[model samples]
Target: MYLKCGLLEDAEKFFGEIPLGNVVSWIAMITGYGKHGLGKEAVNSFNKMQSENIKPDAVYLAVLTACSHSGLLEESQEILLRLCCDSMVKPQVEHFSCMVDVLGRSGWVQEAKNIIECMPIRPNAGI
Candidate 1:
């Protein structure tokens, strides 16, 4: 697709043409933006998705990855907090891994270690 091909502008234009875009469509856009290092744009798309009442499930990881790659430490933490509070979506190990990466990348190694220590789930090899 255009997004996978790195055609972000074309992807956006095509996405906009959908009459009733679903959560999957939004995820594609967010993931594409994240992969392309457009963290702000990814967050904006996430907010827009929420405004439309499309509850986030596992998509938090994508946003977190975006924030991590872009060095948006605060934003990543905020998203993790929101994920923790959302009863409908349980936080996965992958989510925690992304948080650790974000924190560590931002030079918060101690905080990252604390998160690893305090997390209910066991840390995987990726962490």
Candidate 2:
């Protein structure tokens, strides 16, 4: 639970000591890194997870949000797209919101709006 509360070092130690990690363990580390504003570390954790063939679910979107928080829009876009197109995870409104936020934060408000407009499914508010 160190990762859950923003303890990166302890979380890293825990992760390193474990020979095998479940989805929750990996996601916890990714989320922890993201929460602590370590966007690149979060992305690296994501890479580690994928290398282990662990499929990401909605929670991994936390990493996407972290990307936006850190102004890494391009990487956020690529990661989000990969989650859908390559990893086979379905895109939900939360993912779309992350895209919108990323684009908007990057000053591509028009692109963000267009994405919302052209979305196959309309985004419901209050996600």
TM-score, per-candidate, Cα-based: 0.96, 0.89
Candidate 1 lDDT, 24-103, residue by residue in tens:
89889999998899999999998888898888886788888888888888888899999999999999998888889989
Model 2 alpha-carbon drift over 4 Å, by segment:
none
Q: Give me the candidate number with maximum lDDT.
A: 1
List clashing residue pairs in candidate 2: none
In candidate 2, what are the lDDT values of residues 39-103, reduced to their tens digit?
88888878878898877775558788778777778788888778778545778788878888879
Number of the top TM-score candidate: 1
List residue ranges in candidate 1 displaced over 4 A.
none
Residue 85 lDDT in candidate 2: 83
Alpha-carbon shift of residue 87 in model 1 (angstroms): 0.8
- Model 2 gets an lDDT of 0.79
Candidate lDDT (C-alpha), each: 0.90, 0.79
Backbone clashes per model, in order? 0, 0
